[model samples]
Target: MNLNLRHAVISNVSGNNQGQLQDTIVDAIQSGEEKMLPGLGVLFEVIWQNADDQDKQEMLATLEQGLKK
Candidate 1:
């Protein structure tokens, strides 16, 4: 997808209702929806991009630990 389209989807996910966003992402992963995975990655990128340094560090640490599972 183009950068603009990815950014738009990330914005939409960020603005969505909290629980719904989490459910949508988790469901997408669980169902192996290839297209949806990019959206989720964009959401994570957006969060990482916007987060304060300390928060970003914490998030990255959490992400790394999750990946080990």
Candidate 2:
């Protein structure tokens, strides 16, 4: 079977409003389930791809700071 998880994740969240998207992210993180990682990664990929250079740099800096803790 051929499966495209990233595509599936994006499609599942398509058309969601900002509040809905935030709820999805919050729920996934709060659940602490390993299975949610792939969905988060896919969402991150979408954000990274759409972010500008400054936003990407800020995101990287924030990620670095988080990793240090």
Query: Each candidate's root-mean-square deviation in Å?
Result: 2.3, 2.0
Task: Give the C-alpha miss distance for residue 57 in model 1, angstroms.
Answer: 0.9
- Tell me the tens digit of each residue's lDDT in model 2 across 29-52: 999999998899889989999999
Candidate 1 lDDT by residue in tens digits, 1-69:
579978778667666788988897788889896777777778777787889999988987998999999
Instruction: Give the TM-score of each candidate.
Output: 0.71, 0.93
Candidate 1 accuracy as lDDT: 0.80
Model 2: lDDT of residue 8: 91
Error of 2 at 11 (Å): 0.9
Candidate 2 structure, TM-score to reference: 0.93
Q: Residue 31 error for model 1, in Å?
A: 1.2
Worst 10 residues of 2 by lDDT: 1-10
